[model samples]
Target chain A: MRDAYHDELRALTGRLVEMTRLVRSAMSRATTALLDSDLPLAESVISRDKDVNQLCEEIETSIFGLMATQQPVAVDLRTVITALRMAADLERMGDLAVHVAKIARMRHPDSAVPAEIRDSILEMGQIAERLVTKTGSCILTQNAELAQELEQDDDHMDRLHRRLFRMLLSESWEHGIEPAIDITLIGRYYERYADHAVRVAQDVVYMVTGSRVGE
Target chain B: MRDAYHDELRALTGRLVEMTRLVRSAMSRATTALLDSDLPLAESVISRDKDVNQLCEEIETSIFGLMATQQPVAVDLRTVITALRMAADLERMGDLAVHVAKIARMRHPDSAVPAEIRDSILEMGQIAERLVTKTGSCILTQNAELAQELEQDDDHMDRLHRRLFRMLLSESWEHGIEPAIDITLIGRYYERYADHAVRVAQDVVYMVTGSRVGE
Candidate 1:
């Protein structure tokens, strides 16, 4: 019975990894669709969001069922709960990507934000994606060091986020309000995406250490 | 033994409620400090944060003890885990309030952020405080309806957050980067405080219904 319970927990993670993979793909596509100004790619990114959202719901259902039947504890319980929260982060990250895609569609072969801004944003996406994968591996391997390292990476993303905002606000002051709003939201999306990645690492740290990080 | 485990579970919740109260008070002080641009109040908020952080760690230790000694399961496990996560939320909410207070200290006497912005932020603090209290009340009583109501209130805070950001960003675009940075951080503090309030309500809902909200 213990083995079966462990098996159920492992299977829960399998689905989460699959969900994580899909969401990261969506994030990359969303960024590409926006930065490259590809309307078809934007359309696909938006359409694909529904799938990630559905997977999130499905995972929630699965976790609740596993909790009901197996009733996990210690590492097992932490794993299930952390996976559930991470799934939400992935879904939101996916939505941010879709949001970026929408911006691409709005421009339709022209960049809504300037090329320099787009480069920073693409850089932001890459940072967040790397953190997501890092935490994913850390949790899978139960490696606390890898998870803790993500905090530094998250700090880097935050610096980039602030810089992007500072640059945009300055540029918009020279330009106008319309561009300012677009730029601000883009800055926000990247900042939040990075935040979710930080959250994933935090969960992993808590799971392994039995102590919440930064507390 | 099962009854004893349940009691320990309930005791863990009682401790959580205490920490919740402390964190909420810190939030209230932090908000006042922000609006009044009170340096002493801001410093006090920072000093008081240690109390909340300590309580969070203490609660975590207690729960770990319970899990280790009692080996709780099913609902008992859920209760402890929820308590742990909620502690983190409460702690983070304290940080948000401190973030607001730090901004106040940055400017001194009066903020670069406009009075209108300050008033809007005060309004945000009030709504968020109510939500936090209601979440605590709901958890104490296992009231899922109140949890739902708290979430609905979050939607209002969300709208206000968006409205504040749009106004502040537009206003600050005419000025310079620093003011916009201030407004943006303020906007973020409100948004995240509201998010923590929602998270508390989520824990309440999960505790009562054994079902995830919005999932």
Candidate 2:
């Protein structure tokens, strides 16, 4: 029975890592869709979000079942609770990616990324992908140190986010209000995506060390 | 011992209700600050957010203690878990309020809201207040039926969100990129605040009925 309980916990970890993969793919494709105005890719990212939601539901169900039957205590109980949080963060990350894709779809043939800020958006997307990839590694390995690195990546994303704003507000900006609005929202989505990835990594650290990072 | 455990559960509900009050007050002050360009009010909202965070931490500690010692199962287990989730949602609502307040502070003496969209922002703030006030009632009463009302309020919020965008994107918008950017982010903050309030109410429904509202 004890072995079964541990096995169930391990299975929960695997599902969380899988969640990271799905969201990472979603953001990656969503970025390309935004940059290239690829309608097909944007549609794919939006439609595939349900899979992430379904996986989150699965994780919730498993955690409830494990708790009711096993009544995991101490560190084990914390592990399950933290897993629930990580799943939620990953689910939200998937939604953020879809938001980015929808922006790409909204503009359709017209790219949302104005040429002036296109490089910044691309870098933001890359940072989002990198953050989630590292999040998955942290979850899989329970490496508290690796989780610490996500904070630095998130800071870099924030810097890029600010740069995008500067470009929008710059004297040379000729894109008018529509593109500015789009870029503002798009920047928010990428920054939020990075924040959620950092949260998932923080949860990994908490699950491993039983102490919150930076606190 | 059972009585003591149940008492702790009741205390948990009280703390969640307290969280609702804190966030509701925050949003109210934040909205007034935004509309009036009241720096002191905005500063108060920003500083008081720490109180919300502290309350959330207290609730978490209590839940963790209860889970470790009581090993509550069945409905009791679900109640504690749901309380944790509600606390998180409420905590996030507080952050969103601070976001609104910060914008208000940033624009100090110069209103972040323009005359054209002022009515819309005012209405959004009222709806935000209404939604959170109802959220508090739902938590206190655990009325699943009352929880259903939040969905409508959220729908109202969505409409207001769309209206704000329309105003921003309208041909008559002469506020340039800076104020447009400010309003875009501010609208997002209020909409997200309402969304979080709805989520807290949904958790109330789930806690009482053992089933999700929309699912």
Candidate 3:
């Protein structure tokens, strides 16, 4: 009994790491879709979402199996349950990135955003990529400081997001439907991606400290 | 052992129901804050978030404890895992409501928005309230179809949100900065509330059908 329980715990951790890797790849691909303005890459992210979603389900299955079979206690239970929550967060983060990729398709060859937004998207992508990497590390190592860093990273992303929105709303923008929609969707995607990264941090904090981490 | 497992499952269900109640209340308070422009009510939602956070932690502890002890397999594993994911989604929905309340403090009492906006906010509140209720029911009954209804409702909210943003961005009027921000924030909150509601529905589908539902 003890051996089986131990094995499931280890497997649960393994599955979580695998899930995080899928998120990292998906985020990376989605960002590539944004940067290159490649609809096919964007579509691929949308297609590959199933893999992340499947990983999430598999982890959930593990947690349920652990409960029914192992009946884990205290910290073990926390770890398994945390795996479930973390998988959900990661899956949603993938979805947010895919949404960003779709929004990137908002531009036409002749209708690219002005220099101001193009620059902001470039900067925003860099920050988001770094944050995703750090968030995965937080999960892999259970590093609370890395988790804590996500809040600050999210703040930076929010600032960029606001700047992007202001640029869109500023008098400088040429009044057009498609360009405006692109900006709104872009803002929503970046804002949500940061929000998910924060959730990843919160998950790590929950797993490590077992304390309520306020958003 | 079977009876014990059943007892544990019952207990987890009870806790999930309780968590649902807290989220529903949080959403309710947020809606009141929006319609009445009640900053104090919003503050209450913000303050009560600690309670929501505490409840989330408690649920995770409970589920993990059950899993560690029972070591259940297959379908049972899936149910608890879904609960963990649902808890986080519900908690996030609550935070979005608190965000709406925070934006309320920024609104100007004397500045008048177009009549269209007033109706839209009112409509958003009603739609938001319905989604919250649907999510609560979905969680309790594992009602995937009812949850699907909420997904369609989200499309309606999205359309309304797009319309609101268009009006806000137009050069039509001299509404002050605070009001503009307030409206922007409120529109965003409702849109996201609908998004989380869809997430909850997806979870319900997973639990009921054992297949991940696509958005």
What's each prediction's clash count? 0, 0, 21
C-alpha lDDT of candidate 1 relative to the true structure: 0.76
Comparing 1 and 3 by lDDT, which wins?
1
- By descending lDDT, how would the candidates be arranged? 2, 1, 3
Best candidate per lDDT, number?
Answer: 2
Each prediction's DockQ against the real complex: 0.23, 0.93, 0.29
Report how far off residue A11 is in candidate 3 (Å): 5.4
Q: Which pairs of residues collide in model 1? A: none
For model 3, give the RMSD to the true fold: 4.1
Docking class of 3: acceptable
Tell me the deviation in Å of residue B167 in model 2. Answer: 0.4
Instruction: Give stretches of model 2 more than 4 Å off.
Output: none
Is 1 or 2 the stronger prediction by DockQ?
A: 2
User: How do the candidates rank by TM-score, highest first?
Assistant: 2, 1, 3
Candidate number of the best DockQ: 2
Q: In model 1, which regions exceed 4 Å deviation?
A: A37-47, A53-92, A95-112, A140-145, A148-152, A169-173, A202-215, B169-177, B212-215
Displacement of the residue A77 alpha carbon in candidate 3, Å: 2.3
Alpha-carbon shift of residue A131 in model 3 (angstroms): 1.5
Query: Which segments of candidate 3 are over 4 A away from where they belong?
Result: A1-15, A62-70, A110-112, A165-181, A205-215, B1-22, B28-32, B65-78, B110-113, B138-145, B158-185, B201-215
